[model samples]
Target chain A: MPIPDHVLVVDDDPDIRTLVGRLLEKNGFRVSKVADGKGLQQLLEKSQPDLIVLDLMLPDEDGLVLCRNLRSRSNVPVIILSARGEDMDRIIGLEMGADDYLGKPFHPRELLARVKSVLRRARSLPGDVQEQDANATYRFAGWMLDVPTRQLYSPKSKKIFLSGGEFALLRVFLNHPNRVLSRDQLLDFSHGREIEPFDRTIDMQVSRLRRRLGDDPKKPSLIKTVRSSGYVLAVRVDRGGESHGSDDSGPGD
Target chain B: MGVEPDKIVVQIDEDLAEIAPGYLENRRNDLKHLPLALAEGDFYNLRILGHRMKGSGAGYGFDGISEIGRAIEEAAKQENRQGVEQGIADLAAYLDRLEVIYA
Candidate 1:
């Protein structure tokens, strides 16, 4: 028999972990379950799983941070499971490089489908293709986004570093420059998730991203808020290798 | 029949305090049938509600409310009518204190 694809399930709740692990294992995937980020790290060291099923809530560390760390080092596919039904959670998860997001009280069958879909995508992408794409960096507003290394560069001051959320949110904004994106739309396009009512998590993330972009929320530039609507990228974005002609000029003249 | 001075003084967390009033108001509307359940001796349903209250109340950092929920669950399980009534009264008093805290 062929070796089954390995999957890592990270969740603090034993019931959920067991239920999910068993369901995946029964579906022919070799499964390993961990309770927290530390355990996940340990598991990763022991073996490279084909994909990861990660829970946003862990007893020791937030799953977002873990996802960010994982993305920085590897391109392993990740699916986030969050009890928070808010759309912001989904967006943030996707923004942080998660391949998919599933809310709690989810059907076991749905989770399996998502896992299969991500795996299929991963398999379809030829090995080293992501690395080659990453080498082709994009520059906008004096900021350079290194895709493979998963790092950002500030050309003016020569600074480099962007948290996972910052990188993902920036990617979405740059890709859709000058578009008025509602929080829900931002979360959906950026992370493949929805925003929950009465949740300000997305606003918090956007503020964080703005700080990285050197855009002040009080005296805004670059990413501007559309009062009672959403946000829009106010500057032009030029990907690397694109013509550096008139359209590719830097912002603020 | 009289209020117990020491009936679990539940304190609301600062984060939850701002929205507690609105949340409690909505809960009160949904909980209109709660008293009817208690009066009809539907301890099972009461226990279920108590369990939910225990989890969320504790999660939001209200230990006293969770304790009262636990007490209510225990009392209902034992079929202690007076204890159940006392638990309900304590819960109400805690809610009142929360209102005062927010006020």
Candidate 2:
């Protein structure tokens, strides 16, 4: 029998850790549970997990810090589990290099599906095969997005890490820069879901993105906001190398 | 607008109500240090704690508490220490009212 893929779950709450660990284990993934970021770091040193399910409320450290640290070292996918159901937390979690964010009180089935989707995407890509083709690097406003490594580099060659949501949002914006996109349009493109018109979640996310880009909300140079409408990426985009994996691949590969 | 004189009772779960006072008190104490942090322009910690309190308060069904937390959060981001302090006071008042209602 083939060995199941390994998953590391880091949560401070014992009940949550156990619940999530059991849920993943029952879904055929070998699961390891840790109560804090320190334990998670130790586990990562000993064994490379196929995917990580991290909690944002670690007693020792913020999960976003750990996620960014882990991303700087490895391409391992990270899914953040947060009790904060607010859109800000989700947006920030995604902006911090997490592959996905699952709010607390989430259906176990949804968590399982997210894990499966993330694992499938991670495994789909061939490791250590860096494509040197022209389409490998995508450029926008002195920024370079490396498709295979899933890393963004600034004009000075400094790496700009993106959370899963930011990456997806950026991808959609790049695909249709200069076009005024409604929240619904952007949501559909990025998350494949229908959002309520009254939901300011998309607006909060755009504000977060603008902050990361250092674009002033008052005078956005890159992502312009249409009053009472949606957003439009004002910057010019230059597509470099083609992205690896299929177009239908799950995010944060 | 005067809040209802009769104790504004909510049918919160036993566990939630049991923990509500302590949580609110602890968060109120934490708010004291937030101003110092804000003065130093360290909004990250403020935002983090504010976001946490907002989530926890709402989860415990303290809608007023969560609203105050959100207000404090926005004020801190804007560097309005006075606004944050006012928010903290408002939260304390809300907590007092809640205590009376639950008492």
Candidate 3:
């Protein structure tokens, strides 16, 4: 028999953990539950689960932070569960690198469907991290990006942090610098799927990344807006280092 | 007061059987904490508990609980003692008659 996919569930509420665990197990998944980020980190150390279901409001560390840290090293898909069911919250969850976002009070069946869908998509897509050389650092426009540490430094050596979304977007820009990337292409390359209609997730993320890169919103120099098209990174990128993966899988870089 | 049903029969998915008992027990415990929190004017704790219930109840096949939880959370946010009391009473009534059947 083919092995069941292992799913790691991280939530402070024991009830939620147990409830989700039972639901997944009943659906033929190997489920492991953890209460907080510490437990999640401890578990990720031992085994790499096929996917992670993380709660937004964890006691030790917020799920967004955990997701950001996780994205630095692992490509395991994540689905965020949030009590705050606002659109902004969902957008933020996605920006933090969640593969999907479900509001609390959702039907277990809905979560199950999403889990199956996300897993299917993950398997079909060429693993993004695996495509890039592990520990590879990219430098462009007087800024250095360290993939392993997921850290960015300006020309003056001041460290500027990027969320997972911003980091992913920046990496895409670096990989294909000097070329105009349409919004559709950006979403596909960075986030892996087309969002709902009228959703400005890609635009918002680009704005945020530009702000992080100190590019003027009115007339950005680093990542310039193309009229009626998309955006382009107007710089030459220099690549360094080999594909040796980093062992620092702990939270916060 | 509206007419009260003798039993609130909740048909939960059989897949939830393993955790349903503990979930219901936690709600019963919430019933015990409501009055205590109200007495002490601990609206923050009340709001937190209410929010938690609002977020989880429907997921477990207790939409009524989620409704009451939303009411309590809003009342606590506004410091409305009467609304909160009403929510607590409603929760008590619901829990008093709640009957679970895993289908």
Candidate 4:
């Protein structure tokens, strides 16, 4: 038999930590619960987990920063839990490299499916954002995307990191530039998971990308929102060396 | 397993708190501390305690405690002393009915 996946749940609320632990344990996942990010760091130093279920509003440090740092170091999946369904929170959480997001008051089953999906996705690379390949770098708009090392460099040649979500979105845009891609299409291309009922996480993620790429709200330079047809990236994508002559990738094909 | 000589059977009631308490004896230390905590205008502690109660009470098969806990959490949020007091009174009344085995 295969060994059960290990999951670290970090949340300030002890009741929630305990309840999530019980639920995950019942679902055949070995679970460990911690109160805050400090505890999370301590646990990580000793042993790595297959996945992390993180809470956004922690007592000491913010979870988004933690996710960014985690992604910078390893591809270990992080699923964020947020009580606030605010767009900013969702956008920032995903842009920070969380594999998935679950709002508060969610059924345990919802979380379970996400956990399984991410773990399964991590094991496979196709249609998955976190593909590890050396020498596969995509450079566009003075930002260099190092695919293998999972690092992004700024226009000034400084090494700036991109979250898993941000990297995935950027790759999707790089591959299909100068075209209007709908939110549903973006979700399917990047995360490849079903948008549960009324989830608008893709919109938030796009907002985060705009902010990070310094796309101005008024008279934007990089990615522009096309009235009612999602968003379009205007710049040409250079696969490290060669530039695509034509936008063969049509709007909706 | 015999009773000690010269030891008389005595019954007493005390304020206390509990965790998954099935009876008064298993009550938690909050039984005694909650009133004092409230009297000192410590709604923050009350809020934390109430949140714990609200989350765990129902799981432990104490829905009455959960209801009182909800009241305490909401009252603490607004810093409403009367609601907190009423919640404490309800909690005390319910606790009083929990029979404990002295042995």
Best by DockQ: 3
Q: What is the lDDT of residue B5 in candidate 1?
A: 67
Cα lDDT tens digits for candidate 3, A167-222: 87887777656656678767777654323325558889889999999988987778
The alpha-carbon deviation from the true structure for residue A44 of candidate 3, after best TM-score superposition, in angstroms, is 1.7
* Backbone-clash count (model 2): 7
Q: Which parts of model 3 have CA positions greater than 4 angstroms off?
A: A127-130, A133-253, B1-5
Query: Candidate 2 has which clashing residue pairs, if any?
Result: A94-A163, A97-A163, A135-A240, A135-A241, A135-A242, A136-A241, A137-A241
Ignoring the other chain, what TM-score does chain B have in each prediction?
0.68, 0.70, 0.91, 0.68
| RMSD values, in order shown | 18.6, 19.3, 15.2, 17.3
- Cα lDDT, model 4, residue B18: 31
Fnat, one value per model: 0.00, 0.03, 0.70, 0.03
Model 1 lDDT at residue A23: 73
Clashing pairs for model 3 are A134-A243
Candidate 1: list runs displaced more than 4 Å. A127-253, B1-103
Q: Best-fitting candidate, measured by lDDT?
A: 3
Q: All models: lDDT?
A: 0.68, 0.68, 0.82, 0.70
lDDT of 2 by residue, B1-103 (tens): 4566744444444534445566666766775777677778777667655655554465455666567767777777786778777876776667565642343
Candidate 4 lDDT at A215 equals 77
